[model samples]
Target: MTHDTGLVITGLAKRYGDAAVFQAVDLNVAPGEFVAIVGESGVGKSSLLNCMAALDTWSEGRITHDGVDLGQLTEAQAAHWRREHLGFVFQAFHVLPHLDVAQNVALPLLLLNRPDPARVAQMLDAVGLQGLGERLPSQLSGGQLQRVAIARALVHKPRLILADEPTGNLDPRTAAQVMDVLVAQARQHGSSMVLVTHSEAAAARADRVLHLTAQGLQEPPQQAVSAPNP
Candidate 1:
């Protein structure tokens, strides 16, 4: 299996009114690689995600996928590119309260104008929500709601999955479960993933963890914890 469609960023910088949020952050991610970006607040983790996802413009730098300049695309084209190659999961889950789990999951497919009932079922099943499709987000527990979110994210089968603190809202147990599903499915489907997190637990699950600091990214040393008494 080969993925010639990985991500490349060069001199990526973001600034606002003379304030630098990110600077010269060069990163290259190969296909099917999972990378986690960790940073303290205001270090531009979210902003970086936005720029990579083509949700926001970078002040200076280039972002491309498979050598196609992502910035050069029109807004509509960027969004269309997302539908065809990107999936997102946020901390908020973002499931529509008004829609049932199935409908919520189907939203992306509908937006693609290629809704498939079988695809929806498959996504739900992948997230372990088989018969819960008819349940409402409010009726489900935090874990279940997040499962619905995962279902929605993969329903369209995009090539890149971008998750922003995906389990930030859930308890540690639920967070771990959601991460398990998220990681398993993306790898199983050959989708590259970039996740942002502050939790060491979450960061440990990534293929590689790169920290964002004043001087771009560095591989931080893992904290050594003493063993607990038996």
Candidate 2:
């Protein structure tokens, strides 16, 4: 099947042995759109995001981004694809402990062999970490570390962003700040974003909020209202 410039998952499913993690999952994230997935703990929201990133396997159906079929790529090919076109943010703020904040943010550009110090600086400023690039992750607060992760993920301007509970580790006020940065950067880059979170406040910022169940994704009963654009 043909797809335009966006993410498309069709009839996707994941399993281990006889247990099904989720099945019949279908989703489409348009370019520059922000989508949030929410579910109870152990319901595979993170698994679904991993599958979208091609970092994990799915049992059935297809996942495509900008017309490229992820399932058809080999492991090496998948790595290359991710390096070139994907940005990921994690709740754990997976910055390298040894690398200073700037170096950590620049890793993605370095991997693509297109390092741009200006771009790195721009990202740091955009995320409100303007002057802390020289500090180690250990020296920063939880919120600051998460901002570092956001800057790093967005440094290369990936077409798709997959964030798994990025604000889960922060206090409510910090989480809101992080979301503001994340949403602004995603908008600035015009990247499609798929965020999985348990926080209703985080999900409320999405263009569409869907609930993930073992059967598939569906609208929540109340249907989360998207926050107005700032």
Candidate 3:
């Protein structure tokens, strides 16, 4: 699968009745770019990500990916588009309870009708779940389940990756490890990634970090990287 990878959002806005979630948001994610969005809780960060993935409707704006306007696609077409070009990792580890780790990671390839056992194993190893492919979600800890999610999300090499608070449920060490894997995988595949997170360590790894506010996306004060603890 091939696509002209890039994302462009113009005049993006979301509203309900008299309340506006966010508005006048213009952002561009170039191919291979990893952009992180940071904001306070309930600032519509996840909502914005949903709109970017075409999973939710926006009140006004244009969200174009690889020259295709998402708003122009029908629901069925949008689902197809998502299957073909997008991968998502959410705060909740949405792993299938019935399927084992390997099968869960293989789901995207199955959807694309291109099953490859080798790819599944490779992703398992990539996310540090090598020998546990046969284990069910019930057998894994919270951090391990999240690793499976990361592996699954990047297994298909989707042109665009959307991660919403992917490490929200993990300890700081696990979160750092997951962030390392995520950034590494996206860069390796030249995929653009939009990560919404409250973790400073995770956001620090992004190519660009933008703060979300009621007004729009803005550049926050530059944060100095804290040296690693001995």
Candidate 4:
């Protein structure tokens, strides 16, 4: 299988007035690759992914998807680009309580002005939510609710998938299961994924791991997980 060779970031940097987040960072993600990003609090992991996803603007550097520059797009163009090529899974489920399971998942398709009931149901079932079509967001557990979010993201079959703290709110077992679901499905769709997570176990699920720091995303020369000191 051929992958698009993931996003490339060069001279990537960001700042918030007097505070600096990332600088001179470079990254690459091939299609079907799952990348995990981790760092200390306030280290700008989410900020970095946000910029790459075109949700936040950066001070310099360029982010490209299939060779299309993201920083150069107009607002309308950016919106259209995202609708066509990107899918996002947030830590918080972000489900609309007023809408049932199917509606929430169908939102992207709905916004695109195309709705296919069979396709939507297939996505829901893919996430193990077959008959919950009528269930409200409040009726599900943390994991189940997140599955809804996953279904929603994948329903569009976007080229890039950005997940921020996706499992931060779940217990360890639930988080693991959810991560498996995400990883497996993303691979099946051949989507490049950038996951921002603090859990080492979650990071382990990725093919590569990077730390967001003052110097941008840094690939640690030594990669391993160690048990806590006695």
Most lDDT-accurate candidate: 2
**Predicted candidate 3 versus true structure: per-residue lDDT over 1-230, tens digit per residue:** 33474999999999998899999899999999999999888889999999999999999999999988999889999999898889899999899999999999999999999999999999999998999999999999999999999888888888999999999999989998888889999999999999998888888889888999998999876763232343
lDDT of 1 by residue, 24-132 (tens): 7988887788998998898999999989899999888898876668999999989888887888999888889999999999998999899899999988888989998
The RMSD (Cα, Å) of candidate 1 is 2.8
**Candidate 2 to truth, TM:** 0.95
Q: What residue pairs are clashing in model 2?
A: none
Candidate 4 yields a Cα-based lDDT of 0.86
Give the C-alpha miss distance for residue 62 in model 3, angstroms.
Answer: 0.3
Candidate 2: Cα lDDT at 92: 95
**Model with the higher TM-score, candidate 1 or 3:** 3
lDDT of 2 at 54: 94
Q: Give a tens-digit lDDT track for model 4, residues 1-230.
A: 22375677888888779677878778888888899888888888888888988889998888888888889899898898888778999998899999999999999998888897888999888888999999999899999999999999989888899999999999988988898889988998999999998888888778888887777677754654332222
lDDT-better candidate, 1 vs 3:
3
lDDT comparing candidate 1 with the true structure: 0.86
Return the number of clashes found in candidate 1: 0
Show model 2 residue runs off by greater than 4 Å: 1-4, 223-230
> Where does candidate 1 have its weakest 10-residue lDDT segment?
221-230
lDDT sort, best first:
2, 3, 4, 1
Point out the worst 10-residue segment of candidate 2 by lDDT: 221-230
* TM-score of predicted structure 3: 0.95
Worst 10 residues of 4 by lDDT: 221-230
lDDT of 2 by residue, 1-230 (tens): 54457999999999898899999999989999999999889999988899999999999999999999999999998999899999999999988999999999999999999989999999999999998889999999999999999999999999999999999999988999999999998998899999999888899989999989877999887845445344
Flag regions of model 4 displaced more than 4 Å: 1-5, 221-230
Candidate lDDT (C-alpha), each? 0.86, 0.92, 0.91, 0.86
